[model samples]
Target: MGATPYSLVYGMDAVLPVELRIPSQRVMMEAGLPEFEWAQARYQELHMIDEKRLKVLYHVQRYQRLVEKAFKKKVRIRDVKKGDLVVKFDRAPVYDHRGKFRPNSLGPFIVNEVLFGKAVRLLDQNGETSTEPINLDQLKKYYA
Candidate 1:
């Protein structure tokens, strides 16, 4: 009988949003289809111009870090002998990829003995010699 509240009523005749709305002038202007009388087509197209530029910049920065690490030779196998305190890589086995050979050092493993040219036998935390010899690069110097 009287004007129906929108929350309590709905039907094909419900033109509520268009009829019951009072939007700010700025909102209509930004949508560019304001009033359906005038169209500013360029208004919404400019939003991603800077967004794409930012994505490219971020990728470039990551590439630079990789390049620096490669050139500086930060990761390389070294020759470590017994009684030398060294830190192990400590990365988990889950991270090891096919060629990467993830050797996570536990406790900078004490170099109990150098078994062969490349393999250094280590005294693991359990006070037992590990069956596998660790590469020098997998061993980092241990510091307090």
Candidate 2:
């Protein structure tokens, strides 16, 4: 939720829990108010909570966009076209018969089709196309 837990639950910024044990300015101020007036104030705050929540939602979206832009600046954009050769990223390590370590990428799989710029369908070494498209992030261009 966009609103802070404290504000959502309390319909205002929550005073520190210690404020209840010790006396804080807010506690002391509210303490002097008659019970009926205090209840009325709380009811008013609750009625305006929707507007407060809207403000928080806008703030959260703005912050998220800022973070996204910062992240995109450091991203290495990869582009692939039909017929390009690429290697799939392997999640597990592979060992050769000679006990040598294998590279984390496998295959000079052929790019059979480029889909939506974000993913590509590949052709296996046998020239059969894979059923599912692989995300471009999981592939690197194959020079050979």
Candidate 3:
């Protein structure tokens, strides 16, 4: 374990010491080497730091993709199409005062258009199109 989280992730000691312990003389002697050799090794390690950080980033991205794949596999794809009847969920603002038993959703709106990326334009009973496209997640198939 390293003294700090940054040291643990990056595999380098921090510039500022949080705590210190004196090494035993015997341990120091065994680990000690010529100053020039130690400097060269330290320089090599410093040169490789960017590569190590890039590898960590790549692994994190790969892990995210795997998790996304697993999640997508379990999701039920909505089969909405143009002209389908669907109900939009009501997302009322907190300031709006409605009855406790008020319906939590609106519409049996007709699907006027199925746009790109799971969005739809809706039509009310009067055949007027909605002001904006709604996400498919906010709707479900409406059956009479």
Per-residue CA lDDT of candidate 2, range 1-144, in tens?
A: 678988987898777887665445577577797666666766666667778899999999999999999999999988888888899998764556644465678899999988985988999989998999999999999997
Model 1 ranges off by over 4 Å: 1-77, 93-105
Model 3 clash pairs are none
Q: Candidate 1 — number of clashing residue pairs? A: 4
lDDT of each: 0.63, 0.83, 0.79
Task: Give TM-scores for every candidate, taking all chains together and pairing residue i with residue i.
Answer: 0.36, 0.54, 0.60
Across residues 68-103, which tens digit of lDDT does each residue of candidate 1 receive? 989888655576768766676765646445546544
Better of 2 and 3 by TM-score: 3
Can you write out model 3's per-residue Cα lDDT over 42-141, one digit (the tens) per residue? 5666678778889999999999999999999999888998889999888776554556766878988999998998899999989999989999899999
Write down the worst ten-residue block by lDDT for model 3.
16-25
Supply the TM-score for candidate 2.
0.54
Better of 1 and 3 by TM-score: 3
Model 2, runs deviating above 4 Å:
1-40, 47-55, 93-100, 124-128
- The best candidate by TM-score is 3
**Model 3 segments beyond 4 Å from truth?**
1-35, 47-51, 94-100
* Cα displacement (Å) at residue 35, model 3: 5.4
